[model samples]
Every structure is written in C-alpha cells, then in structure tokens.
Target: MSGHVSGYLSIPPLRRDLLIAYLAAAAVTVHVLEAALPGPGPWFKPGLANVFALVAFLRLGWRGAMAVTLMRILAGSLALGTLFTPGFFLSFFGGCGALAMLALLRMIPSSGLGVVGISLLAALAHMAAQIVAAWLLIIGHAGILAALPWFLAGSWISGVLNGLLTYLLLEHFDRHHALLTEP
Candidate 1:
C-alpha cells in the first residue's frame, strides 16, 4: 500500500531551486548580450531570456513564469545599472503583458501552434505594453501618430525575429532538457 501510494505521488524530476538558478544565469547572459549587440533599431533585442520564461510557463504555470520574468527583469536591470530607471519599468510592464498573453493562449485550443505562437503573442503584448508605458510615462500622449510607420515596421520585424529565436530555443530545450514537459 505504501509503495502504491508513493508511485501515485509524482514528484518533479527537476529541483525548483536549480531551475531558478539556471534561469537567473540565463537571464544575465541574455541581458548582457542585448546590451553588447548592435541591432538596426534602438530597442531591438533578442529577448533571449524569454526562452526560460516560456519554458517556466509551460512547465510550472503562471506562478513559475511570473517568477522567472520578474527575476529576469530585476536582475537584468541591476546588471545594466538601470534598476530604478524607465528601462526597468518598461521591462516590468512588458513582461506582465507577455505573461498575460501566454496565460490567455493557454486557455485556447489550438493545433499546429507551438512556441512560435506564444512568442509572437508575447512579442505583441510586449510592444503594446511598451507603447502604453511610453505614452503614459514618457511622451504624455499616444505618440502613435508621430511614429506610426516606424513603430509598425520595427515592432513587426523585431517581434518576428524574437519569436523565431524563442521558438528555436524552446524546441532545443524541449529535446535536450525536457523542461517543457515538466508539468
């Protein structure tokens, strides 16, 4: 009876503490890379840490994803010396938007859509949050009309690129680490 009870209790194969450590490290590395790399646009970033965020969401649900996102933003801001700056606010709100999009996606039933869909949705949410944040905190207006063309083009291109990279990383992690299969 005890053996059967133990068998029924499925313990997580990976330790939560270790996962958090790895995610934090990955976030730091990605943030540094973003700071160092030069892209065509001003805010173009690979959003490499988002891979961990997506994996956390898929594996451990909203709490896990939110943990990773918050940690990543806080740590990344500290690393870049932008802890109390507008950048941190942007990242925080953007991350919340992304998480909301992922949570919403989890509610829907869709086939042939995988991490790419999550990435795209998250990217769009991130952009929306940034625009809102910009207007409320920086510009004091929508500012959409002034930078309409650039905003559209840049957001589309950068979001697609970030989505593609996230999808590839997710596939790789899914096979190599099995992180996505935890839940």
Candidate 2:
C-alpha cells in the first residue's frame, strides 16, 4: 500500500471526494452521449459509462463506485431531461441492481472472478432490474417477461465489451498511476 490509494478507506476524505467527482463527471458525460446515439431498440444501450463505475470499484472501492453511479444517474437524467420519468427510474433502479451485484461479488474471494465476470453479472443484473421495473412500473403485464432473453443477450455482449474496455483502462492506470490499483 506504499504511496498507493488502494481502497476507499485509505484515501483522505477530500481526495476521495475529488476523485469521486472526477469519475462522476466522466460517467455523466458518457451516459449523456450514449443516450444520444440511436440504438437497436428503445431500451438497448452499450452502457459504456459503466466502465467508469467498474474502474471506481476496482481502484477506489464500493463507496466510490456507488458515488459515481448515483451521480451519473442523477446528473445524466437531468441532463437528458428524463428526471422523474419512467426512463429515469429504469436507469436508476438498473444502476442500483448492478451496484448491488458488484457489492455481492466483491465479498467473494478475489480469485473467484475477474473483471469480465463481474461485469457480465452486473450487466445481467441491470437488465433484470430494468425488466422488473418496466413490468411493475409501466407495463403491469406478464408478457414483458418474454423480452428477458433478448435483453439478457444484449447485456451479455455489452458487458463483455465494457469489461474489456475497463480492463484496458485499468491496465493503463496501473502502468502510469502508481496510486491507483485494486485493494
């Protein structure tokens, strides 16, 4: 841990907040930009912004990850003018589900899974949460369940891509930022 900020607890409060702010801003930018792209469907997104959240989790711990996520959702929603809309809740809840999954996975032994595995699982959780949110909050019909497979398929692909991008980013950080690394 020499000279490295390995975990949330290890960082000075001001520095942690500053780091969270920087990560949140990046996540928000990605979230807003991604929303502008035309997707295969209304709900389909590559979730590129999640790479930052994963980076925060790996380098800064759960609190930092959660901070980035919450900020991204709130600020992204506002930026897109989707606040308090069905779309906003979907993103919010989906993000929460992903964070929850990441937290659970974090409790496991580090060797049990790699970044890609965690990303895949988190993506699935995000989709599942969105599906449930749609069913309960909007559709109110069992027919919505029929779309789960397709949504999960999309999640699988996006998760892998995002994870790989995150891996690359982490590698770069490890090469240059001596203070950032897994706890």
Candidate 3:
C-alpha cells in the first residue's frame, strides 16, 4: 500500500509515538515491582521508576520526559488496578509536581548541579505535593502534613540513589551514542 511500514511491530509506533509504549511498559513493570517492596512507612517509596524520568529528561528533553511521565502514571495505575482510586490521584498529582519542578530546574545552567540535584529537588516536590493532596483531599486535616520531614528525608535518599543511577546511565549513553554531547 502506502510507502510506510505496516505490521503489529512496525516502526511507526517507535518512530512517531517516540517509544512511549516501551517506556510505559517499563514503567508499569517497575511500578508493579516497587509496590511489592516494603518501605519505611506508608508515605515512603523508593521511587525507582523515576530513574527513567531523569534519563528521559537528559536524552529526550522536557517534552519527552513529560510524555513518559504521563504514560507511566496512566499505565502504572492501570497495571496496579489503582486507576481512579485515591492512590492514583495522589500519584498523578505527585508526578505532576515532580515534572513541574524538573521543567523549572532545567532552566538552571547545570554547572553546580546535575542529575543528582534535579532528582533531589523533583523528589521533594513530589513528596510535598502528595502530602498536601493527602491532607487536603484525604485526611482533611493540617496535622497530616507533619510527616513531611520523614517523607522528605526518604525522598532525598531515594532521589540521590536514583539520580546516581541515572547519571551513570546517561554517561554511558552519551559515551556510546554521543548524541547528548552534541552542541
């Protein structure tokens, strides 16, 4: 027919969709796996899946990261069967906060800070947003926000861990692929 590849596993999705399906699938796997792990508390999650966000931001730019994050949220929720539930809303808003922070932080020169700084800041925003959502929407009390300290601390630790991982991956990709180093 037309001068385009046609098949279930054709190149169109990867070329046009920009590999969002693959990203979403990976995110879903991570989300499901992370849920099964025990954390310090109900408010604490390692957020390993977010490692992809940092990578996407570095490789694909803000728009790509945004798409990946949105798809991750939707697909992750569906996989976990948390869609439309309070958990999903919390995750959605928290992801939005993280992405918003990342978008702003990208404006920085990235001299003193790198993926580590970005990840830590985004993690803080994510935790803060989730806490606020819980307080205002779920708990309906200001006191629930008190746990923010612990959550923020957890976010910092997890963020640094994930950020380092992202940095390593980017370093490797840039070294091998060389696209990121282009000016």
Candidate 4:
C-alpha cells in the first residue's frame, strides 16, 4: 500500500453527516412505531416522524431534512412491508411535495411565518400531492379529487399539532442542551 490512503469509505463522516444519520434513524423509528398505532383512518396519521424532519431541517438544513424524510419513508416502508406498494409511492410523492414547499418558503427572508405556519403549508402540499398520486397511479379518475377538502382539513390539524410539538421540543433543547442550539 502507498504511504497515503484516499478512499470514500476510509474517510470519516462529517459531523453534519453523523447528525443527519442520527435524525434519520430517529425519524425511521418513529415512522415504524407510528405505523403500528391505530388511527382514525389510513390517511389520518399524526405524522410524528415529520417532527424529526422539522428538527433536522431547522438544525441541519433542507438537505438534512430530506435525508431524514427519505430514510423514514424507505426504511419505514420496508418495516411495514409496504415497499413497492401504492402506500410507498404516495408517501414518496407527498414527501417530495412537502420538501418543495419548505424549500420555497425558506427562500423568503424573515417571512414572519413561524414553524407552525410553515408546517401547515407543507402539510397541505403533502396532502395535495398524495391526492394527485392517488388519481394518477391508482384511481385513474377525477373522483379522488372529491376528498381534497377532508384531507386538507385533517392535514391542517395534524400539522398544527406537530408544529406545536416541534416548537416545544426545540424550546426544551435550547433550554437544557445549548449544544443543540447550534447547527
């Protein structure tokens, strides 16, 4: 071997990458556990996993949040045996839509929108994307559009609750763990 070594695997992961991996693992765990809980309906999940995504975004940035989301969806789907199923596709598209909205919102400097506001908008985007996915992939008809209002309403409620929880969690971290306050 040469005196020097240069390989991707040989390189140690950055702190940011480690943080991303930690957040993704947390999100995936929440996802799997949440999937087991009985909800009002298949679409009415509290989306507890998204709380971790929000935390990742705030602490690590959009890319970190995206990593957590992908990990949650993919690993959670595998755990739930929903891989390659309609549920997985719905989740993938919905997550993409939510991330897209978050990216757009992040561009607006000091928009006065707090975590709750951002979460609400993102949740709506997620619901809309899922509806469209349902129409295009499964139903193949406009009838799926009829459920938009209900889905949006549920999403709004879940988003608000999740945002409040995230806010509280962040506040606690800020008070008890100053290290988490920094990116």
Maximum-TM-score candidate: 2
Q: Which ranges in model 3 have alpha carbons more than 4 Å from their true place?
A: 1-16, 40-43, 175-183
TM-score of 3: 0.82
**lDDT at residue 109 of model 2 (Cα atoms):** 44
Clashing pairs in 3: none
Candidate 4 regions off by >4 Å?
Answer: 1-13, 175-183
For candidate 1, lDDT tens digit of each residue in 1-183?
110101111236356656656766787678767777886675455676776776666555666778888898888888889897987897888888888887787677353455566666687787777778877887788755466445546656666666566556555654554443555
The lDDT of model 3 is 0.74
What is the per-residue lDDT of model 3 for residues 76-116, given as tens digits with 9 covering 90 to 100?
88878889999999999899999999788767643366678
lDDT by residue (tens digit), candidate 2, 122-165: 99999999999999989999799999998999999989888888
Off by over 4 Å in 2: 1-9, 40-43, 177-183
lDDT-wise, the better of 1 and 2 is: 2
Residue pairs with clashing backbones, model 2: none
Each model's lDDT: 0.67, 0.84, 0.74, 0.79
lDDT of 1 at 159: 61
Please give the TM-score that candidate 2 achieves against the real structure. 0.88
Q: TM-score: which is higher, 2 or 4?
A: 2
Clash count of each predicted structure: 0, 0, 0, 0
Preferred candidate (TM-score higher): 1 or 4: 4
